[model samples]
Target: MNGYRKLPTAVNYQFAEDLYSVFKTFGLDLDRLSYSSQTGQMKKLIEELETPDNLQKISQLSLDADFADMKTKHEAFETIFADQAGANADLRQMTSATAIRKILEKNLKTYFNLLTVMKEVAGWELLYSDTNELVKAAKNSEIKRKDENPS
Candidate 1:
C-alpha cells in the first residue's frame, strides 16, 4: 500500500524516532521488548491468533447457542461483559432487562472496536533495506503507523 513509502536513510532514522513517540501515545512500549535471541521464540507464542478479517467470524458466534463446543467461548464473553458492567457504577447497579441489554450492546461495540485497532496494527509488513538503521527504523515505524492516522 502507499502507506509503506520507501524512505531515504536520514528520513528513515528520523521517522523511527517519531514512530517510537507515536507508539508511546498509543500505550505500546516497544522499547520494553527483549532483543535477545531466545526472546524471539517466546514472543511468537504470546502473539494474537487472528488477522482483522477473521475476527468477524469469531464475533458471529455468540451466547445464542450454549452448546458444549461453545461453552468456553460463551463463558469468556460473559466474563468480559460482566467486567464491562463493573467498570461503570451505574451499570453495576442495574438488573433491569433493558439496561442489561444496553450494557451488553455497549460491551460488544467496545470489544469490536478493540479488535479493529488490533487488526489495523497487525496487517502491515516491514520490508528490508540495505542499511540496518533504515530497516530498524522501518520496523519501529510500523509499531505506530499501521496507518498514517491511528485515531
Candidate 2:
C-alpha cells in the first residue's frame, strides 16, 4: 500500500534507490545506472511511472531488469576468469602440478561460490537444464573441458 499510492513515480524512485543501493553495496560506480543513456533501462522505467497501474507493471519490469543486470555481472565475472585462465597458459606449462592444482582449485571454488550467491539472489538455478539428466550431462561436459577455452 505504501508504494502503491503514488503509483509509477513512487515505484520508479524506489527502484532507482534500490538499484543505487545494490551498486553501492557491490562497490560498482553509480554512473553505470546512468539515466541519459539510450541503452539505460532506468530511463524507460522513469517514463513508465505515469499511473498506478503502469507503476505496478513497471515494478515487475524493474525486478526483471535487476535480474538481467545481475546476470550480466555474473557473465562478466566468468569472462574475467576465462581470460585469466587463457593468459596463464604459459603458467600451466611452467608451474609444478601441485601449484597448478592449487591455483585451479582456488579459482573453481571462487567461481562456484559466486554462482551459489547468484542462484540464491535470483531464487533459481542459473544453469538451463530442465531435467536431471541434462544437468548431469552439462556437468560432465564442464568437467571434461576443465581447461580454459577462450571464446
Candidate 3:
C-alpha cells in the first residue's frame, strides 16, 4: 500500500464540479466562478479538522448550516443555483421541481458521509439524531421554556 494516499476530493471538490454539470444549462461557469480555487477552502478546513478544538467547532454543524454557511464550498454552489451571484435564469427553466428534488438525492451518501464524519469527530454525540441524521444542537433553555410554557 502507498504510505500516503491522496485524500478524497470526490466528497468535497468534485461535488462542486458535479453541480456545475447539473446546472450548466443555467449558464453555470465553473471557471468564471474560480471553481478550482474555491475547493481549497474545504481541503484546508478538513485538514484543520485534525485538531480536536477545530473539529469541535464544526461538530454541531447541521447539513443545512454546512450548505448555507458563507465560507463553505456548498454555499458557492447554493449561490449559483439561487441566482444570488447574477445567474442567468431561475432553476425552473431547465428542470422541474421534481428534478430539482431528485438532483441531490443520489448523493445523499456523500452528504451523509460528511455528517457521519462530524459524528465521529465529535465522539458520536449530539450532532445527530437517533436516526443518524444531522440536527440542531439541543438547547436546554429552549426545551425547558417549551416544557414550562407550551406553544
- Give the candidate number with the greatest TM-score: 2
Candidates sorted on TM-score, descending = 2, 3, 1
Clash count for each candidate, listed in order shown: 0, 0, 0
lDDT of 3 by residue, 1-151 (tens): 0111123443343434333333343333334545535444443444444355433434433223543363565556646645643454544357776776787766765766776777766555564455363223345556787899875
Candidate 3 lDDT score at position 34: 56
Question: Better model by TM-score, 1 or 3?
Answer: 3
Per-candidate TM-score against the hidden true structure: 0.19, 0.28, 0.22
Which numbered prediction scores highest in lDDT against the true structure? 2
Off by over 4 Å in 3: 1-94, 130-151
Indicate the worst ten consecutive residues by lDDT in candidate 2.
34-43
Residue pairs in candidate 2 whose N, alpha carbon or C atoms collide under 3 angstroms: none
Q: Tens-digit lDDT track for model 1 on 17-127?
A: 443333344335433654332233323322221334222323333212323333455356557655765677685576989888999989966865665455546442221
Error of 2 at 146 (Å): 46
- Candidate 2 per-residue lDDT over residues 23-111, each given as its tens digit: 34433443464322422443343433434654454465455565457457645755775688678886777869888899998996786
lDDT of 3 at 148: 96
Candidate 3's TM-score reads 0.22
Question: Better model by lDDT, 1 or 2?
Answer: 2
